[model samples]
Target: MNDTNIKWDKIFYGRAWIANIIDIIQTKDILQSFYFKRYLLRAMMAGFIISIITVFVLMVKTTFSLDWGPGLVNMIGAITFSFALVLILFTNSELLTSNFMYFTVGLYYKLIKPYRVLNIFMLCFIGNIIGACVLFGLMRLSDVLTPDMVTMLDQTIETKIHTYTFQNILVRAIFANFFINITLVIAMQIDDVVAKMFVMMFGVTIFAFMGYEHVVYNSCLFVAGLFYEVDHLALWPALKNIVASFIGNYIGGGLIIGLFYAYLNDHGQFKTHRNK
Candidate 1:
């Protein structure tokens, strides 16, 4: 194999770049930053709203468009998600799934001593849940779409979930996290905002096309599923999807690819916090 096509872990974390990420996350780890964290908390709510809008558009194309192709609809949905990430990342908003990726680079590299990868997931999960609830409130208050369309949306979520198994969900979760988080980190590597947006959109497009699980995105979907009054039987699928999503997300950010790379790099190359 050529030098250009090396293992991703080597390129991403081998230089101890994970420490840089730790330094950034560290600045925000304070009592004073709680106010700032609140904004991020609300941003999670905003992310749910935006992500559902993506799902809604996907629904419209699937149900109404004469030329509706699953491929096209999925692509458009991905675009929406891509833009949403750009919004969250550039605007400095808090998104649980993506941040898991960011912080894990630190933990894996030993840059962050106390924060386990699970801690990132737990914080992000709670934050994401709050955001989903905010979106539900919006759906309740506004006459956004027809009742029938709302019903369709509900079924869309329900059916998707009910079909999968625990093991299947776990595998899917791994892919979802691996692909989406990689895209997110790649987007961060870009310096320009516009370029970052394009990268993010592409990431969303790819992930959506592949039908990957993401917990935060699912949080929005869950809210919609509930709002649409999807059947209780459907809840099992959604739950399964989410549980799988959590695992997949962890694999994507913490262990499968980058984090392990970061971990190996720390061991082989640079001085960690203790040495400094």
Candidate 2:
């Protein structure tokens, strides 16, 4: 942790966390849910926008690359996506991965209510769909994707998610989601660019490499995939992906990391748990 942020913050860390927990809990109320919903909606919209942009960027990278080595290609893909992280962390945007720490820490300190953590999840998911659905509509109307490219993206997404069975999906998501959240926390806590860049790079790279499911990413991809005339990716497959991914995302994010953070802060000290 940065020493400069400690002097005053150390005394308030406990209080700050508790406040966060409270905010989370308050968000759960039927009347107060709107606050959390708006945040999630905005986050989902941002995520959708980012995903569309990433696809375009990837199109350029893949089309332009000259038979690059797998190592180089992997690095490019990882680093390219890190752009989203920089935006979210710097902009303080909500992302499912980032939520792992945000709410958990709050629950730990009793700053925010614990139940509110999951509230954001549902809202964000719904909001993300709203945004993605719009993007999908635009893509379908646009002549941008040749029928072939549409098929390609869908197949890729399907292949990525289908690698895991429902049970394995949940299990893989747990660890992958945990690391993803921790990655954001680490990035936020760091100041240097090069270091933060690697944290961003390696963190996303691990998730992509592991083929863990990310509902937000897939949501947009699925929409675009549908627009692009992806074959064999019908309603059933789409529903399955959405439903399974939703459960997995929640389990990985809310149940595992969020609760774990709550446990740590609520019970003991809020120290680093570097799996070293």
Q: Put down candidate 2 lDDT per residue, 1-276, tens digits, no spaces.
A: 664455434543353454454554444333236465557556666676656665764564565455787567656665666566666556545565555555555555555455665666566666666777777677677777654455557667667455556666556666666657667545655679889877876777677656577666767777666656565466766667666766776667665766664564442333332111
lDDT of 1 by residue, 1-276 (tens): 565466645555444355556665664444114564664575565566555565566455556445767677666656655666666666666676766666666665555555444454466567667777776677777777566666656665755576667777677667777776777667656778788777777776777667777777776777766665666435556777777777777777657766655555554445546455
Candidate 1 Cα deviation (angstroms), residue 183: 1.4
Query: How does each model score on lDDT?
Result: 0.64, 0.60
Worst 10-residue lDDT window for candidate 1 reads 27-36
Q: What is the lDDT of residue 224 in candidate 2?
A: 68
Give the residue spans of candidate 1 off by over 4 A. 1-16, 31-43, 49-52, 55-64, 113-117, 232-236, 267-269
